[model samples]
Target chain A: MSSSAHGGAPTGQGRAAALDPKREVQRFDLHQRLQHGLMASSFITLVVTGWPLTTHGIGSSQSLVELFGGMEATALIHRVAGVCMAVAAIYHVAYLGYLARARRLRFSMLPGPKDAADLVGNLMYFLGRQKHRPKFPRYTYFEKFDYWAVFWGVAIMVGSGLLRWYPDATTSIFPPFVYEIGLHAHADEALLASLAIFVWHFYNVHLRPQIFPMSWVFITGRMTVEELKEEHGAEYDEMMSELERSRPKTPAPAGVPAEAPPAPEDAGGAKP
Target chain B: MRVLPPTGPGFFPLLGGKPRATLILTTLLLAPFGTGHASGPASAPTTAPTAGKAGPLPDGALAADGFTGSEKIAPPDADPLRDARWCRLCHDDDHFESSAWRTTAHTEQVCRDCHSGYHFNPHLPAELGPEAATTNEGATPAKRRAAAWATCQPCHKDAVPEEGIRHGLPEPGKPAAENPPTCRDCHGDPHEVLLSKSLPPVERRRKMNDRCVACHGDAERMKAAGLDDHVPAAYGHSVHGRKLDLGGERAPGCVDCHGSHETKDLKDPEVGRATCGECHEHATPDFVTLGDHRPFTLEARPVSFFTLKFFGWLTFLTIFALSMHVLLDVYRSVRVIMAANRNDDTPGGHA
Candidate 1:
């Protein structure tokens, strides 16, 4: 249900103070936005086109098949979308590898022990069992879960989908049941992924009261300071401390504790 | 062994030599699939379930001109069905066969060709129909139907294969009263067999399936014929059947998977997959697990069975839990929002 899975991952091109120097802070980069865009389009295409053929054995009707003009045409469109998704996945992996090479990648989005504690604490606060909300770091557990789901979902879908697409080649290497398993897994995983995106991701990212309409961080790749403080208070505190050090000769921005002199006109604006 | 079917927009089998080709060519050339089967006198208990269903013709069926090629017999106006007398002068008023004989694939054939058994001279009229009430032929017309059925074996020798006589016609020795149904039951009146050449593949398939449904869909008729009525019910709910019901052009009809001159060679699962693979490329033997209208259960359809259960449960449980989380989050968020709003309204501790 997280809107900004990749958005929370810092680019390391600039720190948060250098990102905007204005009221807004950078949450996602252009690359992250593009990747999300690709994933979103291809995933939607695959689900719409694939659901009919995958569920052809059941309640899937002629209208579904006819929606894409028939089985042959639907199949063709499914293949094209499959290829696009496969490419998008490869592109993501390659980008991650490049980030690792540049030593710019951080493991903040990875799951850690604190995430479980945070989830329990957050739920307690929601249930009025606690006085305060749980403090969140750069990425929440939900965002991490959304990220890893795509990672796992893409692997399973692409692997099983390839096996199904080339059944003759697949069956030659493995048994017929292997192909059948691929078919089963492909269809089931699609349903699971679709549900996760529609219900969980949509609610957290777009439908939740706090993020209703949308979380514009996905589009603008930035969140305002007040929103950053509210949503990711831990990250905001850390960035404010860094901002404090960076502007030792100047004053802190308003709403942040001013521990230094008045600010200079030319701030460290790295064009966030 | 079953004959590997001839593939094309084929009506007759494209089995080896010149004769089969000639037959198909003539059938197609005749612009077959005439709109209406000439109105035979009513009260044949064996007709299709819907009356006048066979009356709906395929496109371009009636061109006023039929086969006039040098290869076959040509009437004066090149219209074989409307040809005058030797036969139609008296037969048109008496029999349903003469009026629409050209709509049938047997358009090239004349009267004595099928009737010559009763007549010694080819040109002489065979004493037939109501006028021949005193003759032995007219006294027992049911005998004439059996004789007419016997005439089909020669030209349509490939149709009644050793493998496929399981459904319609019984053994030759069985009397007319004992016979379950002959060719006319499924194929419409003997004179008009709803020429397949004139129909597009899907319409042809749909019309062919309509005939199958005629006999099989009727539970009472199937039971009377000592056949189970399960097939019609099962097939009607099948993916193929549903597509056909929804007017899909490429949907498999009764004979697409099951062979024509319909029978049950689909017992073998490999054969079943092969039939499915006609349209679905790379259809493994694993795919046809639901063959023969088997229930969609674990035993019959293990993969799909497990897929349904697993995915069904997963979707339900995941959505349910997530929805609960969302609701509690919403209620808590709303409460927090309200509390903050009250404090702001008072500009103090109104909370």
Candidate 2:
């Protein structure tokens, strides 16, 4: 994989080396991979510790609580996990701001008109109604959905959870009912987020036929050139065209050996 | 070789589980019982005595016609001419408890309604053998008790309530004997049952309180029932019990919170809101929705129930759709792989 910053093709000498047809391509950069890792760990922790409290008094839930050394300890772990999620959310926003200022923000992750068409095209192919696959860019609609789902989930869970965690203080500003509503939203959204990750995201990233047993892209932040060709052909083609456009070309004025026309002072100068 | 029950002085063993303090208090209050009558706040008839030969009114009032000189209101549906004379024959103080029975609300009922075999003379002859005494028809102690309890079920619908809780019934197939609560445990003997409403307001409240506490306050008994031993003390100290102690009519007692017969686990989400709603009707919906209770599980709260249902369906749909998509993709991939494999197996199929 390209180990350069911005996850784009390396320039100059490294570019020539990457021109090989079988080279690997950078997908997620270091910052992005770290953000994903943080989110994943925090989410798992929250689901583990929070589920028992949500289903308190049940035999299984009580046993889980005991396993964690009682409700107090489990609750403490849940709150700590919640705080980590909040930190990850804050860090992600900062990272986004940094990208936006740097003019390096890739709008490919944003949903567009093409996504709907691609979804239909992909479905048609899956249904055996078509032969050619729906050529995707860097980010497919599924990936974008997964990305935004986390953002939405974090907003809901953090907002509601704060009220529930500090109800005494929150109740002073908001009515008691607000706190309850917040808790409901928090807990319900948590379950939804957890299921989506385990089913949708897991299936797409790790459990798909070819990727069974896991995909190392999450850890390596890289995809092979074959994968880029198969999965993100449009992105690969666009990058190739840009590279061609930016290549240095020899100037006509450098070869002034034969009869050459002299440029006129008043008219636009013509050179051989 | 019979074992004597552990009890304080003058403790009434007839009530199987009354605490020592409660028994002492009952004895103190019933000190006048030696006079052949229970004299207390409950003894006073609610209505004044009539001036002429007349029967007692159901509400204990003298007939209005006697004082106002107007047409008398018809008495209740009780048959004044019912032959219960045979009941008094064998049930007089000489053979049984007849004093309290005469004063009970059940005076209107004939003896046969309860003791089904009482109408006939079932007494064995004096020359009967000892084995014949034990083998008498319809005379087993267990059978008699079962018949008497069965007679109560029609009127008292939930004779043994909260069947789901089993009210401390033994686990199926276990050797342990469970002391399940029965009707007599709270209401006392059916023959001489005194209605709580018949007592004065204070006495009525105290009677209801004491009736429930008699069994619930026994720490060992509560533990055996898999119930909270501290429940009686907790109720006694709560705002409801405290206010009842202060003679406030608004305060709810034990029966009001945990129902008299239909007592269920308060851990139920709906029970909390519903029980509280009886008094704070307006606040019930808000109280229930507001999640005052913690660790709300799917079965407990309506919100959780609906939330779980929504997520459960959503999860099912999402998984089904995604799985179908993945399976189709896998199928297509496998078909291509097989096709490629076949092509390679054929002669001249180059890489």
Candidate 3:
């Protein structure tokens, strides 16, 4: 295991990993990570400030409200968080437009026919019907679902939240009921989103046995070679082929080896 | 429940629920609680009673410039209920002690219906009768006083202690000081049950508005009870109140909108529509579909409830399915990780 795993893994087709020793694959670009960081911070702020109001006196909500000065202060902080979220959402839209204009727009994160197939394949693997797991691409169906869910969540929450924030103006244009609906939608959706993050998203990204404490991929924006190979093998293969095509153009001038030593033939990439 | 003429405004064949049922059942329920009979226009007020001057002069007498000489007008009837003179025989003419009945809507009602303890003993003169001696067997004066509300509750059954508005009734075994106001505290004395229906409709509404505002207006009381302080004032300034002030006969009063007996908080979503429906029978659906009683908050609308319920179920289902998926995914991932770890630890194994 150590021999084949640490050294260059040579396949039957003679496909080999080229020279990088670190074996670190960039999963998220700086722009995407910054957006994620902003969103995460804004969301946290919102939950901290707004949750006290939502739950009122339940649990530590009262203490939390007191900690933030008073209801008025807490509300002000919530508004600030709301503004932050708005900025992040707007930035994301602008980023999408930039991507479109630059002609580098990729719909890899968008769900497609392959995602459906992958979901079924993954379920089969989970049930032990398939010996090998599905080879995920740059974005799995789960990650796509998260992305779209956020899009939907942000739209509803922001629309309703803004209406609630400016009720006097809202009621002027719309019926009183519209303002009321805004409050309900904003509050209820916030709770649902918060709970989803704490439960489902948290487990997948952090609390799962494999990840345990957390996966630092959001912060580091990189994945280990094994992780890239196992979880996102298809993306890893694409990256490798791209690297192979480009490697000759950027060769070292000195006596450095171009590629690592290949695994022994006896290893055969066999399982225990 | 008012008596519905075969085709009166109060009766609608299309109307549904308790109001319609109450109207239908009025004939059956009317005879027993004689106070609220759905009969014709209520009886006319008789000439104000001029009782024996030997008793303390009624409070209003001092306010009057002078007293007219008592003419020997025959009493209306020998009915014990209607005659304030009967009560004045033993009781003084304080605010509601005896002759004050002449000033209120209850001049037509029997005193015995409300004040159950004091009874007639014909052997003695009406004034010197054993009013105290002939008591309600076991009930103390306070208990009898408290129980007297039982008489009002039969007609105003909606405002029972549990199901009605939060009137701050003391919990059982609590001190009497914590007890909510009895009927008399708000309605004034039973003998002089401050009736406004006999007045002009505008005056009636104004009088009711005042009474409702009395309790709801008390900021300290409302705060102590954890009730909304702005509600009474808000209601007074609402479209209904304004309409009523303009003498809109169809306009709703406090008792009309908030049931006298079974009053709930106006913000209660479940009751808001039905309460509005009592008057705006045709427009109830629209009112309900577009209504939001949380005038203070913009977080709610008629559609809000549906959205909330829908999202609540959606959240539950989504979380449930996702959690299951997560568990399965985790199990598989953990197994893969463990296998990889085992292979890594092995001396002569592969990746």
Candidate 4:
């Protein structure tokens, strides 16, 4: 396939014209997309099943309870949702480990000095103290924070929930009071995490300016060239530079049969 | 006297006898006084006896002066001198006459030991005027005794001592303010004081449990007692406490597991699940076999306690960190917008 098919948007024009159609390359693959879909669905199910018990009152909770068929039904749904989440988590870990072993994965979304600098620089810019936007790497500080938060939230909720689910077994190896403390911590933390997702994460990714409708990166797994440049200028520049360096040298047009096109074996193997 | 009737000698013999006539007239004249004497001393006064004399009397004599001439009339079946009121009458002296006066905790205390001089009768009707009754008129006698027992504060007022107030039973030398168990509060009847240890097991348990809930059930008191506000509420809803309230025979109570007069502090290692297990055999065994319910100490049950605690803390910390991360994400987005705005304002600043 031509580079245009993978690196740029399609158009009726020839490949040369298609190469500059103002779109960035895909960031997430099929596996990543499937994982994200499962995570989202399972999390939504968990919230629906679990939140009624926490916000127990006479109103909406009663209807929810009935919807689930009763309190026992609600509990059963919660447990089932918990199992689904647990399975999803296990699959995620295995997949991540596989990817890491194969050197196909890199944690590019971790926070570093660049993120801190971005925060301060952006704050100054907001206060009218700066004249330029801060440059960002492959991921902005917020995206890095979001990514890390999901991992942390998943780790906590699954770990605590499992301990609670098998309290008798846990107590066999641990003190009973530990279970009580675990119960309290798990419940309160879940509440905090869920609220934060609803209020802060949702607002940033879906309600902020310019991204008012939604951030299509999560849905489409791709971003436009302008969006990549605006949000991750440094990363875009580095990627462009790398692409230019790796481009194959063009041969003379229709003359001398291109000098045998330099034996196919001598070209740098093949592009990924 | 004429002797002309000598003809009917034998018939007229005693008809003229002076000794027999004299005897009959004398017996007739003394009948009223004799009957009065046979009825015991006709000098005892009868009215509701005053407080000092209303209980069992210690000495057999009139200790007070007011009834000296009123005839000490002991009922045919009862001894007047041994009567509680009779003793109080003569020994009407406040310093020593009152029956409850010589009790250990309230020696020299008058009739108002815990009664507040109102609603002194345990059987008083529930709807009596409030001012004329103790504050807890509608409460059970046991509960009233518990609340009013605090009346010991009038004289022995001070916060109850620490060691004494730590557990179910009052500690020795506990001040009235702190350990104010009135005479009747713990002892039942002011007139029927007995050694706590000597009481029947069942009676002792019931009385002790009754007193505990008096302070425990009170939200304010429980808060002051360093317990969770929800403890009482939880206990009230618990199977044990509920069954007790419903009068279930098998239900455990505060004193059923905890000792009546010698209740120990919950912190005592020896007093943990073992103590609770005394009566709750099932619960205790479950706790021990399952290794639940026992207090975790670093030196004692380290591995078990720490494992659970570690998971708990880890879970909590992770959630907290995630929440913070989400919040920071929001902040970063806001910053991004602000940065974009600034960049737009600057010429040729587009990335």
How far is each candidate from the true structure, as Cα RMSD in Å? 14.2, 21.3, 19.7, 20.6
Q: What order do candidates take by lDDT, descending? A: 1, 3, 2, 4
Interface DockQ of candidate 2 = 0.10
Worst 10 residues of 1 chain B by lDDT: B41-50
**DockQ scores of the candidates:** 0.22, 0.10, 0.16, 0.06
Name the regions of candidate 1 deviating beyond 4 angstroms. A1-22, A54-67, A245-272, B1-158, B161-166, B169-193, B197-199, B203-254, B262-295, B340-351
Angstrom error at residue A84, model 3: 0.1
Clash pairs detected, candidate 1: A1-A200, A1-A201, A19-A272, A251-A261, A251-A262
Q: Pick the winner on lDDT between candidates 3 and 4.
A: 3
Tell me each candidate's TM-score.
0.63, 0.49, 0.50, 0.48
Predicted model with the maximum TM-score: 1
Tens digit per residue, CA lDDT, model 3, A97-214: 7877877666676678989998998898887678776788767777777787888888988898888676555655677667656867787788888878888777766776645777
Question: lDDT of model 3 at residue B310?
Answer: 77
Give each model's clash number. 5, 0, 13, 17
Encode model 1's per-residue lDDT on B22-140: one tens digit a residue.
Answer: 43343344334321222111111111111222222211212223321122222334322222221332244333343454456665665544554322101122333332332233334
The runs of at least 3 residues in candidate 4 whose Cα sits more than 4 Å from the true structure, single-residue gaps closed, are: A1-9, A12-21, A248-272, B1-217, B220-229, B233-350
Candidate 2 segments whose C-alpha is farther than 4 A from its true place: A1-16, A54-60, A168-172, A175-177, A249-272, B1-320, B345-351
Best by DockQ: 1
lDDT of 4 by residue, B30-128 (tens): 445442223222211222222222233222223232223334433333333333332232323443334433443343333434444322111123434
Better of 1 and 2 by lDDT: 1
**lDDT head-to-head 2 vs 4, winner:** 2
Question: What is residue B326's positional error in candidate 3, in angstroms?
Answer: 1.0
Fnat of model 3, as a fraction: 0.30
